[model samples]
Target: MFPLERQQKIMDLLKLKKVLKISELTEELNISVDTLRRDLNTLTKQEKIEKIYGGVKLVESKFAESSMDERMVSHLEEKERIALKCTEFIQDGDCIYLDSGSTTYQIAKYIKHFKNLTVVTNSIPVVNELMNSSVELVIIGGKIRLNEQSVVAYDYIFNFDQLNILKAFLCASGITVEKGISDYNLEEAITRKKIIDMSKEIYVAADSTKFGKDVTVSIASLDKIDVLVTDANLNKNMIQKFRKTNTKLIIAEGP
Candidate 1:
């Protein structure tokens, strides 16, 4: 792998494992010990990571602790662009599922432009956005997460088998070619898993920043997604990496 790509792989590994020994990094990256040390030194100088006695750990990131409102505005332009591109997949009279996320909430803003659409979602913000729109809205009911502004239908009583979700637009905290898609919350992951199983086409809407990252809960493998919608801000290297996978990627152009 190229130096930049190798460094990114190191970062990705560190995100998933939190900390790693130098030997582990060398083995995982298939690089020499000297090369691994060089990469670690670079990351240290960039203030993105810290080297321990024999291992390295990522620096604390503000993005990890951000609230729903903060996340909503974190990458506003890119999220908006991604959201608009996702709407192009929807057609009149389609039963679509919108997974709870800041990016998907932007999709709700364009709900009025469609005709005879049945919108199913777990996002409170999406529900509010479509409250007065002409499209029919169905909400997945369960415990509501105040910080995420999302509802998790974890109880067995809530049946997702009945819903014929034509297209599912999902969001993820982290997505990678090897690890697939993941989220920080388990309950929300459970809810998304159910919806994904029923949907004909799974469309994951995530900003470019989400790439090369992994979180706690595994939602599904990358192959399960029919298409991944991301903004043009995504690096070319990541795009090339994803192209090697089976999942189709759609890059939304910016203004």
Candidate 2:
């Protein structure tokens, strides 16, 4: 594999396993020990990982946020399924808010049929997707977050307050029964919080993998979310936990 691809695989493995030995990485990548060592050294210098005695571990920090590219490739089918389900709640001429997230970005694909929908979003990808569509696109302009390709600024909070959003669709880095909805970036979380307050109804589009995981910042409580849209792979135990909350769950079955 190429060096960049090898490094991305190493990072993905580290995210899944937390820590991995050099031998394991060598076996997985089918590369020479010397080459893997060089790759690890480069990653270490970039502060993405730390070398231990015989292995490397991810730099576990509260501020560690995954890039848009990584998230886009992680759960492609599940996100698409959930996005399709989201269309059921949308109608022609409705004003809605779409957060800067991978799943929410997918919603743009299924919303093309809406003739007079007004979409307010902070995601650059979502903006590009609907720019030429019949829907009126409103971008939350502010400081651009390069990794996630979203905008966040304190001034934009007031802009959200001025609009009457019928529904706001969001995605989270993690979701738990207690901590509610959370994300890795504080600025994005703040932006989401503002949108949540402005909208009359709230919907969270999250994959099953996000359940039970608590990340750095909490956006809102479960009670604030009117509906939860996820893939059908969600287990019964998780469904029961969500049942205890005020948020109604919608399982998106595949085609």
Instruction: Score every model by TM-score.
Output: 0.76, 0.76
Worst 10 contiguous positions by lDDT, candidate 2: 153-162
lDDT for each residue of candidate 2 in 166-244, tens digit (9 for 90 to 100): 9999999888889889998899999999888889999999999888889988999888989999998888999999988
**What would you estimate as the lDDT of candidate 1?**
0.87
- Which stretch of 10 consecutive residues in model 1 shows the poorest summed lDDT? 62-71
Clash pairs detected, candidate 1:
none
Candidate 1 segments exceeding 4 Å error: 1-65
Give the clashing pairs for model 2. none
RMSD of each: 12.0, 7.6
Candidate no. 1 TM-score: 0.76
lDDT of 2 at 82: 96
